[model samples]
Target: MAEVKLKNLTKRWGDFVGVDNQSLNIKDQEFLVLLGPSGCGKTTTMRMIAGLEDPTGGEIWIGDRKVNDDLPKDRDVAMVFQNYGLYPHMTIFDNIAYPLKVRGTPKDETRPRVEKAAEQVELTQFLDRKPKALSGGQRQRVALARAIVRTPKVFLMDEPLSNLDAKLRVTMRAELKHLSRALQITTVYVTHDQIEAMTLADRVAVMKHGIIQQLGTPDEIYNDPANLFVAGFIGSPAMNLINGSVRDGMFVTTGGTRLTKLPTADRARAILGVRADDMSVHEAGQGDIDVTIYAFENTGESTLLTVQWGKQRVIARGDRHLRKEQDDVVGISLDPDHLYLFDPDTEQRIRM
Candidate 1:
């Protein structure tokens, strides 16, 4: 396996820019994820690396060779797409064997390689079945098996789980994680799903508007976001960004409620960043601020209480067994150790 490098990489069409001068280093055998919303250029960046899209500027290096002019097939990269790019008429075995067959591998070399790849993805029993006969998850595994059959220097997966149902997506995530570790191949995964990025990535590059907002491990991006975009985009419910100002070492909300004390110096305009998990729910008047519940949700694993806090509604995570109704009064206190401050003007975190 070879490490992939992008130096000042950029993609442009006319005056519109798709990827704006982004540089990344994906180490060999590393599972790196490019995470962001649609049209954020994550897909375009991967396409450029695959030689499917032309870059306006910059170099792409795989191992010791720069592959800017290489064809997609010549780049030694296998890509699995969201739609499970497979032939409906071909048996699962044939699909997995396609890459080797196309590359002119001997018939003797093809069968065992295909069979081994199919077994790795738990598709051995379904090898004789065509893609149309398999479930969504099974089809995706066939796609993965096809990729791995090549044992390419790098694997590019683009939202390979988005088409699966929620439960199957979860199951596939675990399988994908295990497959990645076992293969020990460099992989670049693209997805807008924060949960996938958090669970699957060794390190995540969070992107927005064609720019990388933050690049770090899942813990660093979640617990210590570099900017407003990362803080808001990286979480399920997103970090609550309350409009406020810091006065005399205390943060005050727009409604004149002094929310929390800050260790940083005073800022005339700032945003207080806190996650739902960082706030503890309490009985009425038991915590720092008392407010009425705007909405209550029970999501099996945990309960979410959206409470009216001054002029804004804030969501707080409650114990799974905790039940509450709308209009119920409750108090929520912030975890001071996890609180984050950001400059509203620049959207950058204010570190003490």
Candidate 2:
């Protein structure tokens, strides 16, 4: 395993800058994920590290050696792409053994290593199957097995599960996490799916517009986002960003609802951030705000409630069994400790 580091890494295509000056340190054996929406420079960043794309500026280091000028094959890294790039004519065993063969490993030694990798990915039974014969998930497993067989210093995956069905994707997610832990390879995975990043990464780098907005563990990024963008982006229902003003140590929404009375310390902030899960619903009179329920979506264990206070809508998550219907008047309570404050001018987080 090797530690990978990127210092002021940047990439551009003509007038458009795909990746801005971005720097990151990935520790040895760490699972780091690059997460953001489409056109956010995530794949561009990954391609640079994999040597598929050259950076216009900055340096890349694998372990202690600067690898910015190194060829992809010489970088000692294995990459698994989204499309599961397998040779259609080759059998699963031959596909897995191709890297070892290209590197000139003895034929006797290559067989056991290929079989071992296939076993690790539960593809040992299908060793003789061609890419045409395997299912989508199985083809991906072959790709993964091929990457694993190389035993490279670092593993880079760019949304390798995107093509799989939902159920298969979940299974592969768990398998990939386990395989990474077992192999202890330094991994850098890129994806736009927040759930994949949250579940698979030891640390996640949330990016937007070619820049990292936040870098933290799943819980930290979800519970304490660094800015309004992050708070609004990382969650399922997303965080509720109510437009309210602080006046006389209290928070008041535009519709005459007093949601929270902040401490002197928190009162100075201009905006508040609250997560959907942190807010609870009740009858209109007892809580801080009266909202007309716009909709309620039942999501297995919990229900996502969309409530409108005047013209603005906010979501709150609660137990699915707790029933509330459309157009029902409900009271909403905001948990102050869970609330995040942001500066209106900078759109950055403000300490309470």
Candidate 3:
């Protein structure tokens, strides 16, 4: 187990900067996730740490040594790519044993290590089969077992679960989480999927345009976003951002409806943010504001109501059994304790 550190790390192609100067410290045995949309430089940052890509400027340190000049093999880290890079002709046992073989572990020492790694990932039953016979999830486990077969100092996984189907991804996520906890290895995971980051990370670094926008635990990133982009990015339905202004301590929507009271001073422009689960739905005129429902969706677990608030629409997660239809009028109320205010011009959060 080791701590991974990036100090003023950067990557650039001519004028295009893939990773702007960024610095982060991932603790020993910590599961850190780099999360953002595509082209946000999360993968680039991980590549630098893995020795797959060199930094344009800055340092990459793993454990007590500076690994900026080391080759990938010398860096002592295992990587699991998105494609589950397994050899087609090798049996499951051979695939898992490749790392140990390359490093020249004795023939007698190899079998038990491979078997132990396979057992950790629950692949013991299929060791005799080849990669072609295994399902996608099983193939992913093989890749994982291969990585763990060597006990490298650090583990770098770049969207390792992205190729699997949705259900498979969830199952693999649990397996990955369990494995990480049991192994206690430092891991840096890259993914654009918010759900993945929220579920697997001990700490999440939300990035954009090659810059880390916010670094926090799941709860902090979800409940206490540092900026408009983070508040809008981390949630499933995302936080509903409504354009408006603050006047005399009251937040007024663009359509002239005073939505809620703000403790801050009056401002000409502001943005109101509230999550779907934070807002409640009710009969027309029963809650804070009455609006016509534009669309109603039943997602089995819960119902979602997209209601019109002036020219803007806000989605509210309703009880699963609650029924509503398009154009139906329903009252919407914001959870004052859960509300967020942001400065429109700066796109930064405002202290409540």
lDDT of 1 at 167: 97
| Better structure of 2 and 3 per lDDT | 3
Mind giving the per-residue lDDT tens digits that candidate 2 earns over 232-296?
A: 88988888777777787787766656778776453444667888989987777766777888998
Residues 1-352 of candidate 3 have per-residue lDDT tens digits of 8999899999999999999999999999999999999999999999999888989999999999999999998999999989999999999999999988888899999999999999999999999999999999999999999999998999999999999999989989999999999999999999999999999999999999999999999999999999999999999898899999999989999999999878889889999999999999989999998999999999999999988899998989999999998999998888889999999989999988
TM-score against native, each model? 0.98, 0.96, 0.98
What is candidate 1's lDDT per residue for 202-293, written digit by digit as tens?
99999988899999999999999999999999787888999999999999999999888888898789999999999999999988888899
Scanning candidate 1 in windows of ten residues, the lowest lDDT window is 259-268
lDDT measured at residue 344 in model 2 versus the true structure, 0 to 100: 76
* Model 3: residues with Cα > 4 Å off, grouped in runs: none
**TM-score of model 3 relative to the true fold?**
0.98
- Scanning candidate 2 in windows of ten residues, the lowest lDDT window is 262-271
Global lDDT of each candidate: 0.94, 0.89, 0.94
How many steric overlaps are in each model, in order? Answer: 0, 0, 0
